[model samples]
Structure formats: structure tokens, C-alpha cells
Target: MSEYEFSSDAALLDGDWVHRTLREHAYWAHDRSREVQDAANAGSRCFGVYERGTGRQVAFARVVTDGATFGWLADVIVDPERRGLGLGKLLVEGIVEELDALGLRRTLLMTRDAHTLYGRHGWEPAAPVGDWLVRWRH
Candidate 1:
């Protein structure tokens, strides 16, 4: 098995690596700027998964939370080259575990095509999707 280590420490995160991965791979953040990404990381509870021993960061995620009532999981990305190793599932699981410990009333996330992955970690589709709304900025 490939050993992995998970952490919620922001200081251990590699901002440049994260920017590159999200900008190139994540559909939600393909146009996200480094400045915005850095700011987001600064404000949220960030998580990273590193390959044990090598200390190389292989995955990243963040949660916007009040530490009590709510949280929104966002920017979950694993190195494309490292997919199929179960990193994404493991990362989401760890994030959910942390959120659950906070006693939050609800946690939300939006994904274009990762429902199955998130479903395995206890996430379910929010019914009446129309009740949720967003305003996009161009």
C-alpha cells in the first residue's frame, strides 16, 4: 500500500503547486488566480495530503466554515498523475471527519461530476436543487 499522511495545517501547504493543479485541472477553478487562491487558503481551513516519507503534497482541499453551524467544502483536487490511488476519497473522508467533530449543522459542496466519490464519504445530493441559488460574476 502507498502510505499517505494527512494534515489540516495551512503552513504546510504549497501554494504554487496548488495553484497549478487547480488552475489546470479543476473545472470549477480553472480560471482562478493565484492571488485569489492564496486569499482563499488564508481564510479557510485547508487540508493537504502528503506522500509519507517523501513529504510531497499530493492532494488539497479546503472548508469554509464557521466552526459551528455550517461549512462548504471546496477546491478539492488531487494530482492528476496520482489519481486512482484513492487520494481523493481519503482526503474527503478526512475533511468530513474534521467537520463532523465541529458539530456543524450542515455542510455543503458542489461538484460537476464527483458525486460518486463524495457519496462514498457520506455526502448526498441536496434535494430540490432549485432552492439553492448562486449569482455569477463575470
Candidate 2:
């Protein structure tokens, strides 16, 4: 068993923690505003990884989906202090499993780095069709 609990419950998410982490560390969301993050969460399927004992969110990710054919994953971040414990892999794996259950035609995400992490979860560069099929098989 892992030390973290993964959840898709928006209610369990810590928006302030997410906002601050992304604002300070994430290259893509460094300048993103709270309003935008809130709105994004409101419209997307949000996922978080929490410390099992304290229920404190330690990681976050969200996917903008139509609940059918497509999903666009965004804002994937793990608390810097907790990075090497495999929390990121756990989070992304959970998200992929959730999406796979939806049976969506495609799920997409973009990253400037961390290719190795995503790749381990079956994500690939460009040509989303292959990536979708690859992830679906797992």
C-alpha cells in the first residue's frame, strides 16, 4: 500500500495549495490567476493525492472532458517536498485509470519536461491516437 490516497473528489482538493504551488513552481501556470484556477476546477474533473493519515492534498491534476470523446489534462503537480516518493506516478496512474473507465476516445496533456514520468504511464509525444490507444490498453 502507498502512503498516499488518490481521489477524484473536488471537495477533497486544496485549491489554495494547488494555486500556490503552481504559481510558484509550474512553468505553465506560474502567472495563472486564482480566478482562472477556480474556474478551471469548476469545469474540469479534478484529482488529488493526499497524505493518508492527515488527508492533506499533496498533489493535483485535472482534466477538461466532455465525458465522452475527449479529455485535456492540465495542471499536474506534486508537492516539491514529496517528489521522489512516486506520488506523481501514482497520481497520473490514477487519473489514467479514471479516464480509461470513462472509455473516452482520447485524453491529452502537454508537458515541457517530465517526459519520462508520463512516458512510463504510456503517454507519448504528438499523435494523440497512439497515446490514447496505448493508455487504454492499461
Candidate 3:
């Protein structure tokens, strides 16, 4: 049996777990407000990874897509207590499968530290550092 399982059922996601992980642990969303987080959850395709025996969520990822040709994978994080067991891989692989099923030609993500993990799953730097520009609002 697999040690972990992935589910795209957003209903299965524990909002408290997700909020705390992002707010307290994940660098990317450490200052993100709960209201914004809830809104994001409402808008994206969310995936969660759980331990097989306990069904406790240990990792999460979300994709914003146009349902046709493009997607952006974001907010991927693994619970610190559960890192290094390949749950991140399982989570990303599950998301990729779902995105592929949607027939998206390109999916993108930005990470300061997970390039190797994403690379193992077929993600590469998007045209080198300065080649891409992002305009942030707020």
C-alpha cells in the first residue's frame, strides 16, 4: 500500500491546517490573511495529500487554470513535520496528472527553494531569472 494518498476533493482540505501551514510555516504565504486564503481556495483547483492510515493532510497544492491551455501551480507546501518522505513529489505528481487531463499546454510555478523538486517532476526555470517579469499589485 502507498504511504500517502492524493485527493482533488476540495472538501477534504482542512482549512485550519492549510491556513496554519501557510501562515506559520510557508515562507511564501506567511503574512497572507485568512480571508485572502479562503478566497484563493474558492477560486483554485486544490489538491491535498494525506497519510494513508490517519488521513491527516501533510501537503497541499493549488492550480489556477483557464481550463484549456494554461495553468499556474501555486501555494505548494508540505507540513514541516512531514517533509522528506516524498509527499511533495506525490502532491505535485497528482496536480500534474490533473492538469494534463485538462489538456493544458503550459503550467508554471515560482519557488526560491524547490527547483530541484519541481525539476524532477518536469518543471524548469521559466526563461532564466531576468527574462520574465512579474508585476505585483499591493
lDDT (Cα) of model 3: 0.89
Q: Give the alpha carbon lDDT tens digit for every residue of 7-85 in model 1.
A: 8988889999999999999888888899999999988999999988988899999999999999999999999999998
Q: Which RMSD values do the candidates have, in order?
A: 1.2, 6.2, 1.6
lDDT of 3 at 78: 93
How far out, in Å, is residue 78 in model 3? 0.5
Each model's C-alpha lDDT? 0.90, 0.90, 0.89
lDDT per residue as tens, model 2, 44-109: 999999998999999999999999899999999999999889999899989999999999987778
Off by over 4 Å in 1: none
Q: Give candidate 2 misplaced runs (Cα > 4 Å).
A: 128-138
Q: What is the lDDT of residue 45 in candidate 2?
A: 98
Evaluate residue 102 in candidate 3 and report its C-alpha lDDT on the 0 to 100 scale. 94
Backbone clashes (count) for model 3: 0
Higher-TM-score candidate of 1 and 2: 1
What is candidate 3's lDDT per residue for 36-98, written digit by digit as tens?
A: 998998899999998888989999888988889999999998999988888888898889889
| Model 1 TM-score (2 dp) | 0.94
Candidate 2, residue 132: the lDDT equals: 42
